[model samples]
Target: MSQQDRIPCFLLAAGRGERMRPLTDDLPKPLLKIQNKSLLEWHLGALRKAGIQDVVINHAWLGEKIEHALGNGSQFGLHIQYSPEGTALETAGGIAKALPLLKPEDYFMVINGDVFSPNLPINNILAKVAIFRAASNKPLAHLLMVPNPVQHPEGDFFLEDSQISALNLGAGEKLTFSGIGLYHKDLFKDLAIGVPAKLAPLLIAAMEQNKVSGEKYVGPWHDVGTPQRLQELNAAYE
Candidate 1:
């Protein structure tokens, strides 16, 4: 598929960032700066480079600041839209709420706005989406898995030969979810709009049926959940 035909993407920015404390006390976590640019800006630049045009950002806390900073996304060569929530809905809830804006495509990409991944393998994931849709056993989601960070040592899921499962399946390597995924619209069909729901339950349910897929990404990736990590990221870039 051509770049223009690539799927739309959603940047999940609605979280309250309670972990970031005083920093998030004023600005939304996605708006936090790394290498002098906002976290969301980095993702937007990467998305544009990956040939994605339409973008949706969901925000709750200090959402106006996000709108003010990015505006219509013209500067970054993207057409941006916002899905504002009265309160921060969990992952699946936010995606469900933004479905209308993302309905143009059968599958859409979602990335946690707070995470910092310089090379997210967007094209590779898109290629996987095409393969998934063609298979008889259509998967509801394709996730990007990374090495578990110190903060999350147990990790989240296991991958064996491209098939992801909640179980270890004996010896497959376990990895932490990178907070980035390509999801089919049908995945959220049963979810009620504006309802608070965590994404893990949905993913785990699909995993039990062998309906979720994943790939390991061994490149630079960071969750950036704390002030120290933020400073560390900035220093690394410098």
Candidate 2:
């Protein structure tokens, strides 16, 4: 794909994975295996299938191992770049630090490297990029909302006719942020590079202004946060 047509993707893999304990003691969570392939590998394959050639992965804990494992991504038909953080920057901070590599685009796709969503609807999101760009309000982000998993029963935000809002407003059903999204670079303009910040506050701020849009995805999605869940997925995949 041409440069303009190529939507750069940033994979957020820098978390400490404190909950994963000994499994994460030596290996970063993204490198954890599922069905004989690394979790990050699954994302790489999916992105490549969606025609996303340019990818940036941020890593902190056991970051070098990730670099060693993926190399230049040639094997996967992708151009992979690393944004190494001294410490695991929260989601927003990691993306902000990687902005230089992802620049020259009004928006880009970001996915949480730790999660697994085999059918992420990347093509649909790319199709909406043009629509979002031309919108009068110029929304800064478009999120993928999924049915709330048992782990997060309260859910995160409510979606009404594709417009996302922080308040339920007694409207559409509340869903969980799937950690898969299309984000405008302008959303992080105010953040200082290298400093840590969470993405939720930024998303919430935009939601209040009606500057965020989202769609509900009912698909096989898994947040492999704990070793038990990982084992369960491995068994199911087996």
Q: Residue by residue across 68-177, what tens digits does model 1's lDDT show?
A: 99999999999999999998889999999999987646788999999998877888887876687679989999999999999999999998998899888977899999
Highest lDDT: give the candidate number.
2
Local accuracy of candidate 2 as per-residue lDDT tens digits, 1-238: 5666778999999988999998999999999999989999999999999999899999999999999999999999999999999987799999999989876378899999999887778999989888977789998999999999999999999999998998987677899999999999999999999999999999999988889999999988999999999999999888
The alpha-carbon deviation from the true structure for residue 221 of candidate 2, after best TM-score superposition, in angstroms, is 0.4
- Clash pairs detected, candidate 1: none
How many backbone clashes are present in model 1? 0
Candidate 2 segments exceeding 4 Å error: none
TM-score of each: 0.97, 0.97
Off by over 4 Å in 1: 1-4
Candidate 1 local distance difference test against the native: 0.91
Q: Root-mean-square deviation of each candidate, in angstroms?
A: 1.5, 1.0
